[model samples]
Target: MLTDPTMWRPAGEMHRCLTDGGSAFTEIFGTPFFDHFARDAETAAVFHDGMAAMSEPENEPIAEAYDFPPTGTVVDVGGGHGGLLVEVLRRRPGLHGSSATRRTS
Candidate 1:
């Protein structure tokens, strides 16, 4: 969707369009982005797999680039599955972290 022409429109216009109930995702896929995922389990799985594959390569680099305090808690809000937090905790022995997001039953 990043490469979609509609996504490249001016920010203000896009926001206005979205506010008016227009969706670039709906235009391309006949549903809003997340709705498309909800409607297609296979596609959602593939998309998540792709994201995990992409995140793995960056985790080590991200872990090394940052310096955490010797002992403190790091909260990764909305970080899916806590991959980065796990890496960070691995590298920083005394640091603690949590990946948290609200989930509906």
Candidate 2:
């Protein structure tokens, strides 16, 4: 649903004219993405879990592609499960920092 073009479809008087962002989706769904997500707990959990799962496959190549400072601090903002952070720090060594978005129950 995220790249749904119809969500941003233009309407009358909006023929290539810009308007407030809400005007885009409001005409169709009456609510925006964030609002919808917040209102639905199951959907929110799915989105969060999906995002966390996506990080694992990218960790190896990402670590291989970049050469982090041999010794310093590194932080992944939403470093889900610490997969990428662990790979990077393992490769670089001696780096220290904290992930602000650590998951906790």
Number of backbone collisions per candidate:
0, 0
**Residues 1-104, model 2: lDDT tens digits:** 22334333534436433744445545555665446556765765665666667677888899989978878889888664678888887787688866766333
**Alpha-carbon RMSD to native, per candidate:** 5.1, 5.9
lDDT (Cα, tens digit) per residue for candidate 1, span 1-105: 333333454343566566776765676667666566777767665655665676888988998998878799999875656778889999998998887743322
What lDDT does each candidate get?
0.69, 0.64
In candidate 1, which residue ranges exceed 4 Å CA deviation?
1-22, 101-105
Task: Looking at model 2, report the run of 10 residues with the lowest lDDT sum.
Answer: 1-10
